[model samples]
Target: MPQGPNGYDLTVMHPFRGARYKDSVATNGRYWAGPLTHFAINTATYLFTYHFFANYSTEYPDGFLSEQTLKSFEGVSGERGSFKWKHGAERIPENWYRRQPGNDYGILNFALDAVGALQALPYMAVIGGNTGEPNTFTGVNIADLTGGVFNAATLLEGNNAMCFAFQAVHSAAPDILKGLLGNVVLAVSKLTDALDPILAQLGCPQMAKYDKSLLAKFPGAGAGL
Candidate 1:
């Protein structure tokens, strides 16, 4: 899901234009820009969330995460943890981020004594721009970045598939799930390929390859790694 662009630059020749014309231009710009920006941000957030979680949550011998880290994070082994639906739904008391770490979301916590010290100047300065006027910062939205139930579910499916793929690769055995996920990745990578120009322009990271054999092993074994 590649968003072509978040916004545009409109240079209107306003010397002879009426006030209504200028207002209409501004209103129309805001109207279309709002949804375009929203859609772009939403799509970027989902992709970043999925790729970040999928890559980071992976367990080692193949991925960066260690077994103990997975245990501590999920309170279960990587294999078992992958199947569990984990997200920030309020109803679930054991939602991610509730464990040993402090529940307070840092300086934003209202209960803190230094709440007054947290001045609005800095926020306004950054958000309002150097000219002391309102502006838009188009970037990752952290609040919505983790995503919701659907994201968790799909991530689990992909992660579980990755786990199975790794297992099958190690055992030199074929797994249907591994093949399915691998094919999905390959297929999706095609879209990334098509959007490479835009993605590169934005400096967005793309998942290059898992294991070289991920593509080869599922359909057949005994190929070189």
Candidate 2:
């Protein structure tokens, strides 16, 4: 059922009961980066239609959205966001965003990077040179670091996952995609593990949701984040 880093579970069911979260997310009304519209008219028409029926779109109540790049903005929870689902005890929307949004994405959560890969993933190495770019989920640009900027040492050194799972997916080989997904899950867990104490240190209980136990089931991705 699990596929892709953001818990792209294929077994996801219908509107209200089984897959209600995704359905709700479809209506969440926030514009994410990089969704392709067939044409400007099509895009405008969709937006117009959405806005026109904003109050009553059966598919989405909040509205349609795409995804965001990681490590692009500053002050972001460094915690990934989550799926709209209400599943396991740990599976909660707030908790997922507390971890890495694109990495080991909690079940049914989606944050696909532009072009479905981290062609230019965003991240930082504060201990080294301080790229000086703020990090966040949306409006991020490519991070030339272009490789793994992870591990306990990296964490202590002030390095950010930056690209999150989008990096793993892009950096992987064609045959290694599936394994890369697992790695993304591991990375999300790792980031969450790293994020928890830091948030606690900062006295932000609001950020606790991004902790490890919540996002235990990272999916296997065949596609993008």
**Which candidate number has the best TM-score?**
1
Relative to the unseen true structure, what is the C-alpha lDDT of residue 150 in candidate 1, on a scale of 0 to 100? 18
Off by over 4 Å in 1: 1-37, 41-182, 204-225
lDDT for 175 in candidate 1 is: 33
| Candidate 1 residue-wise lDDT, 1-225, digit = tens | 111112110011111122332343344422111111222222233232222222121222111322333344443433643644345421311222221233322212211211111121112111001111122222222113222221222322322212222222232222323565667556555544654454343332233222333223122112311
Per-residue C-alpha lDDT of model 2 across residues 1-225, encoded as one tens digit per residue:
322222221211111122332332244333122111111122233223222222222343333221222112111232345334223333112211222223332211222211111122112111111112222122222122222333323322211222232233333323344455667556656656755554344332121111222112212112212
Query: Which pairs of residues clash in candidate 1, taking residues 3 or more apart in a chain or in different chains?
Result: none
lDDT of each: 0.26, 0.26
True-vs-predicted CA distance for residue 211, candidate 2, Å? 23
